[model samples]
Target: CELSSNASVSPGNFILHPSCDYDGLIPSVVFFLSFLLGVPGNIAVIIFRPNFQHLSSVSQKLMLNLVVSDLLCLLTLPLWIYAFLYMWTFGLVACKLLTFFVYCSTYGSGLTVTVLSVQRYLLVVHQKNWTHQMGVRLLLVLLWLFSIILSIPQLVFRQVTTLQNKTLCQSQYSSQAQRITVLLVEGLVGFTIFFLVVFSYTRLQKKVKQAAFFNNPQTTRLVTCIITSVFIFWVPYHFFDVLSAAAIFLNNEDLLQFCLTALYTVKALHAVNSCLNPLLYAFTSHNLCCKKSLSPKI
Candidate 1:
């Protein structure tokens, strides 16, 4: 949502929400907890391994990239909390730069995860020759670069706005048309990446059934964890997004209000995915791997 309006001449007229106190507190709490978990969890992943230097698998590297991005995203969350709790004290430049970093990190996390799945599918099912590809180091660099480029819009478009004498930090897209454009781009890009992931897995599943690794329950659980959360979290948000787009396109006043409210809740639920992934997918796999590594030799 557009946080505040930056039109200097008419500073106090752009308040998007009615109650800043309530709005500020709720998200501040949520994002604070997220930052707490994300920062330490990711750092420990790197630090806890004894042979961290030697450990280099395609999947592991991708996961590392994911954690790094999540950490970056979490770091910026405090700025949001600060804005809500106090005021837009950082001014416009800090607001846009901080928000841009957050968006970049977000895309990095999503894309890294998606690519990890594809990598797993390839290794497990296709048995393709992955060698001579410059390995995980190159891929990690590419992931960050891709994330930065994709998040360029957020950097270029976001700004601080003042409404009703309160300053808010948010991305600026003036009209419904612009909002739709951003939403559509996000939906299309996300769908395309996810579609590839799904398709690759579908083809891989048939082969997995015939492979020895498929017999491992952990493998099954990992696949299930990623796909289930992605669908469950993203689908509702997108459903509401499509509805919002429809209302805008159709000029349905009543539906727009109803859908926008619903969209707010759905988007909140979608953000929960960030926190849930670490607990459900990452921690579980870490536990499983540790168990196997510690098991007695036959």
Candidate 2:
């Protein structure tokens, strides 16, 4: 909506426009860490999923998909860091492609986790025969399909632009209205899925207080860890986007620019989520020798 940050604005009083200190090192280190953890973690999950007889459950397959998505997203981080440092040296097409892959993997991971939650709900609440209906193959197919569809907009809207002799990869929405539409849709979808997961977990907890299977500490821990990771990593970023969208509508340039830059940090943090997922979700299981055993599948 407002012009890009590179757009000219008359230099006002220096006192009025104090320089904001942005810690560039934090992002560079974080991105490096993410790439380090995400690659091997996702690979291990993928490799062990079929080979490990203990964790060969249907639910584990979805977890593998989540790890794979995280890894894919993480694999692009070096380029992201380079882009941030060198201001998107990769040309227009490469910029678009990289941005597209990033969004596709991130959104795919989000949707996969949401689907896992819904599957858990179905299994625990209705106790239905969903495993046969939506096995790993079917779920994997749908996962890729949904990811591609949701990612189309990124491909359509992203562009590479030169600013002060440095290129930057950015979304190039044709209209503010379309951008708002996309944000609204993403918000609604995220909220809906989040709500369903929390509600289902609440109901599940209430019913299983004394049951041995229900009281399994590992199951509770796993769910708590995953939920916490998602909330901590995503909630701030999503809320920031909401504020950015609202600011755009209000036509507040200064506030919107500040918010966008701040959201850039949050976006980088969100990228870190994929890296953390493997640590929070899979690392403990493997270490405890629990990866091979399905004590309780969440």
Candidate 3:
């Protein structure tokens, strides 16, 4: 979804009306703060890479990619804030380019989490093997390639249009069918991958509890927090997107407006995940290191 310009009085059929005229101001301020927090947090993760080297190769790589993806998404927020504050004065090409990057990064981060969950599942359920490491490397490459391919549609559909004497950047679908198709694709891909991640983690948790072997409370708690954080941060965004798309498909203006308003609020909440992730990492590292030091060598 794209950010709408504040100057546009009418919310349009696809857009939702905010409860107040200055609703955009709240989100803009939130986005600006998120950028300030997320950039530094993610950069710190990159700079402190050696501290995380104790994590498995796959886990380390996935965490790094996740940070990079979040950073890419966060980098586009300043542009979005500008659009929300004034208008999309960056012209057509910049609009498409920035939108493309945002979608790419969003998808990339989601897929990375899915892969990370699977890696953790494998580590707990199966014996370590060289082949698993090789497979993970290959999967990482495929995940990024798929994310880029999925994001190409955004570049094709997004346009900068003049509305109420203000230029706005948004997805300009030619038909409702086109919009539905895009929304369904995005929702399905994100939900499907996240579902699999949750399933894998659930099963892993069950197996770990059943065996009662190598069951570190700190590790278990950290994993639970990570999974919970992912769900809390992303589920609402996807749920609201699906609801908004359904409203559009049914031509329910009232429902569409409500969903859009809710979406506008949830979108900032979704972006907060990037800022929260670094803190999660810090907790995970500290807990795991302490666990390692205390555990008996078998």
Candidate 4:
């Protein structure tokens, strides 16, 4: 969903029922809490990175990168909250920049999680080869570049427009084809990455079962947490995006309205993923205090 327009639309214009206020209010509270929690949690992940001696591993590095992505997304929450409560006063430049960063960080986080799952699968199911670690830094650079490329559509399409004398920032598609194209790209990319992650984790799980590797419960727990967290936060958001795209393609106003209503709730859930990652790290790694010398397993 386009964060600015979908979220900042006046309740009077969109709310069909009296209870619609609850829908908006609850998710607004969720976004607020997510911002309060996510910022410090991701910061802690960076400040207290694992202290492995061998430059750590791909998974460790990916975790740090994941935090960076989440933090970038979270930094825009204050603006989001402001827009949700009032209106988008940030103008066109800030609007485009914020939306661009959100998309970049979102795509980055998804790719990072997918790659982390792949790294874990390899480590768990196959013999670790030095080549797996080769070009780790370069891979990260490419991932961010890819994320930027994925986000280019947002920068190109988003605009600041005045509505009812209220200035707002939102995506302004010139054509139905353009809208569907962007939505399809976003949904497909997210689903593709998540599908890979799920496949890798499924294989890893089967391997763990066959190998009876329950002796190290922490490893299994960590994998479960990562997979579950990513899936829970992202799947619904992408699902709604796909549905919204279909609604637009079909010119189904009812379905479009339903998708928009659901978007706010799912968007908040999606943002909560950032806040949950650090807690997942703490619980899975047994490093709640951040000073522990535990080897990074995820």
Identify the runs in model 2 with alpha carbons over 4 angstroms from their true place: 1-23, 50-56, 133-136, 213-217, 283-298
TM-score of 3: 0.84
Pairs of residues clashing in candidate 2 = none
Model 3 alpha-carbon miss at residue 278, Å:
2.1
TM-score of each: 0.77, 0.81, 0.84, 0.83
lDDT of 4 at 200: 86
* Model 3: per-residue Cα lDDT over 135-159, one tens digit each: 8678888988999898887678777
lDDT of 1: 0.57
Query: 2 or 3: which has the higher TM-score?
Result: 3
- Predicted candidate 4 versus true structure: per-residue lDDT over 1-298, tens digit per residue: 2223332211111111112224356666877898899998888878876432323366567878888888888887777766665666777888777778887888888888787767766655664433456599889999999999988876786777765444666677778787777777777887888788878877876665554325346556666776787778777777877888888778887777777667655667657887787676432443211111321243
Model 1, poorest ten-residue lDDT window? 6-15
- Which of the numbered candidates is closest to the native, going by highest TM-score? 3
Model 4, poorest ten-residue lDDT window?
Answer: 9-18
Expressed as tens digits, the lDDT of each residue in 1-298 for candidate 2 is: 2235432111000001112223444576778887887687778777765333433266667777788888888888887666655566677788667766777777778877777666655555555425463566887788788777876776786667655455556665666677666666665655665666666655554444445434356656656776677776667666655666676678877777876556555556656778777666555543212211223333
Clashes of 2: 0
Q: Please report, in order, the local distance difference test score of every candidate based on alpha carbons.
A: 0.57, 0.60, 0.67, 0.66
| lDDT-better candidate, 1 vs 4 | 4
Q: TM-score of predicted model 4? A: 0.83
Q: List the residue pairs that clash in candidate 1.
A: 4-161, 5-161, 5-162, 12-164, 15-163
Off by over 4 Å in 3: 1-21, 128-135, 210-215, 282-298
